[model samples]
Target: MGTHYEGDLRVALLDAAVLALGETGVDGLSLRGVARRIGVSHAAPAHHFGDKVGLLTAVAARGFELFTEHLAEALSGGEADPVAQLPLLTRAYSEFAENYPEHFDLMFRPASVRVEDPEYMRTSGIAFEALRAHLEECQRRGWRGEADSAALTSAAWALAHGIAVLRAHGSLARHYSDPTLDAVEDIAVSLLF
Candidate 1:
């Protein structure tokens, strides 16, 4: 029997799942493990999330929501010029990845979560659209030269994602200081514009 969870069971399960993800990763995460983390019966997570994939999909969706917030904040906090905002957004992306490693891992691993899940699509789309909108603005102002905005957005995302992944895995820090990394990221973003 599941213990009575007085709070929002769905949110509780998601929180426990994130902790479980940090410990076990996608392959090792189980509904039973998440439930156990919260002192509930193993069936509790299944009841809330249908199955492991469903649970992971929820985690990914939540991750995207948070990721979008970070990007939006970065966009608002930076200069009005879209070209100038690229580095800020890029820094936010890396910071998000660094701060939320488990969510970051689950968000990008489509094989681990249902990419077709509507909430997943909506939240992830919002995050990407923020970047796309900024890139479009840059194109409109001719700040990015004649490069196709769509391609530029993709390149920008790739660069930021690459840096995040490299830093998360300790590859970037092994070779570069924080200032050096910032300089490298600035140079890379400069190349895009």
Candidate 2:
């Protein structure tokens, strides 16, 4: 008898892809492997995603959606002060990276996924705007100096991204004496802002 999969195959495939990416990293993930892991035919992933890049693009899109939700929830749990919000947002970004390293990795690697996919574009924009809105408010209130809001937003994101990437890749622990990502993240954020 042939294997059967009920529910949404697309979602199942994405979940399998995320897990496979975690195990093999991006370079080793394949449509056949993802399908095989889920007991689906080898062509299932390609049918839904067109190719490996398409599957990765879908993964990146889902990552952005989850990422945006993470940021929104973090900001909403705190006071409205933009200055106060930075640490929360920074921590949330890093936490997302730590919690979803595979998604985080694929989300930032532009060359690995389709940049023009509508879902990916929309979700990623929402994630960026979450920080952009906060930075704009900070600039308006003179809380982040006189630098342009765009530059300030990008700088803040870059700082958080750098920390997250380093931690994800295990380089932070190798180079720094800090015993925890939180401690290093706090120090980095406090130093600049």
Candidate 3:
């Protein structure tokens, strides 16, 4: 057997939770399952997470962290028009979903999981704030109107999110003969700009 090394059991539990949630979703997630997948005893996850909700809170938190990181990287290319950056970020969002299907599913699916914990809320806020910061930059650059930045950001977010949802569900393939992220982003940006 391999050597057993560990420091933060919480981190281990979170990692396992992400894998389990991604595979089976919230309804199918089990503390024992996570523990087993990590090669630990069935009781191990409960020792660190207290319960399933705690474990999911950690998973959602990590997902938001990753989402924020991806968005930030997508926006960092220093394009002259931050509005142009919108399509890039949108593509990045969809790419993240395609690459991490489970994480994407858990992050957006309403019925699959419920993360009402305050810590989860705070973590989710990080992703929202990242997007809001970009929108604020757009307003500063005169790309946006004097209207509410929050509303504008929400609209843009919805556009990207809708495209991602359709693509993930294989719905876009039905309607749009060629539903590439670049095409989706191009159409969305053209409509906005």
Q: What value of lDDT does candidate 2 attain over all alpha carbons?
A: 0.86
- The residue ranges of model 2 lying beyond 4 angstroms of the native Cα positions read 1-4
lDDT of candidate 2 over 63-134, digit per residue (tens): 999998888887887588877677767778888998998899889999999999999999999989988987
User: What RMSD, rounded to one decimal, does every model reach?
Assistant: 2.0, 1.8, 2.5
Q: What's the TM-score of every candidate structure?
A: 0.90, 0.91, 0.87
Off by over 4 Å in 1: 174-190
Q: Against the unseen true structure, what C-alpha lDDT does each candidate score?
A: 0.84, 0.86, 0.77
C-alpha lDDT of residue 42 in model 2:
91
- TM-score, ranked from best to worst: 2, 1, 3
Pairs that collide, model 2: none
What TM-score quantifies how close candidate 2 is to the native fold?
Answer: 0.91
Model 3 lDDT, full chain set: 0.77
